[model samples]
Target: MNTIDKRKLSRPNFNDPIPNMKSPSPLPDATIQQKAKTDAVDVLNARTMAILWKE
Candidate 1:
């Protein structure tokens, strides 16, 4: 097998957490609001791109 295939096989899946790693805590309200605002901007940008592409 190639190096890429070996690397892929060695990598851990998302469900398998790394050893000694702690679970993430819940996000603060301000952080959640900031993330929501960023996501909204990303959605708006994607829609604008789609409209421009269709024209």
Candidate 2:
């Protein structure tokens, strides 16, 4: 088995000084999760009704 040197690992140099910049704008609020949950429940209800009405 070959052994590796721990010092040979590469890492980011954060010791250097860097300029501060403005962060990106927040994402838009899309009520997708709520809509999906409601849609799932609607589909489930619809399937249940179909099964119950079937002869």
Candidate 3:
């Protein structure tokens, strides 16, 4: 018969309370960001076209 050793068992320390730090919330919706990016691109294209037309 084989006997298990009690000295090899590991235990956690319960003397201190764990920190309650929480992660930040998720980012805003994807569609809103996409709209902003598209608007920026459109503005840049309009400016470029205006400059080319003036030259």
Candidate No. with top TM-score: 1
Q: Please, what are the lDDT tens digits per residue for candidate 1 over residues 1-55?
A: 6999999988878788676554264887678779989999999999999999999
Give me the runs in candidate 2 sitting further than 4 Å from their true place.
1-30
Q: What is the lDDT of residue 50 in candidate 3?
A: 100
Off by over 4 Å in 3: 1-28
Count clashing residue pairs per candidate. 0, 0, 0
Measured with C-alpha atoms, the lDDT of residue 33 in candidate 3 is: 74
Using Cα atoms with residue i matched to residue i, what is each candidate's TM-score against the true structure? 0.53, 0.44, 0.48
Q: What is the lDDT of residue 49 in candidate 1?
A: 100
Residue 34 error for model 3, in Å?
Answer: 0.3
- Mind giving the per-residue lDDT tens digits that candidate 3 earns over 1-55? 1233443344444665665433243655576678789999999999999999999
Model 1 ranges off by over 4 Å: 1-25
Candidate 2 structure quality by residue, lDDT tens digits, 8-50: 3454457756545322435333455567789999999999999
lDDT of 1 at 9: 85
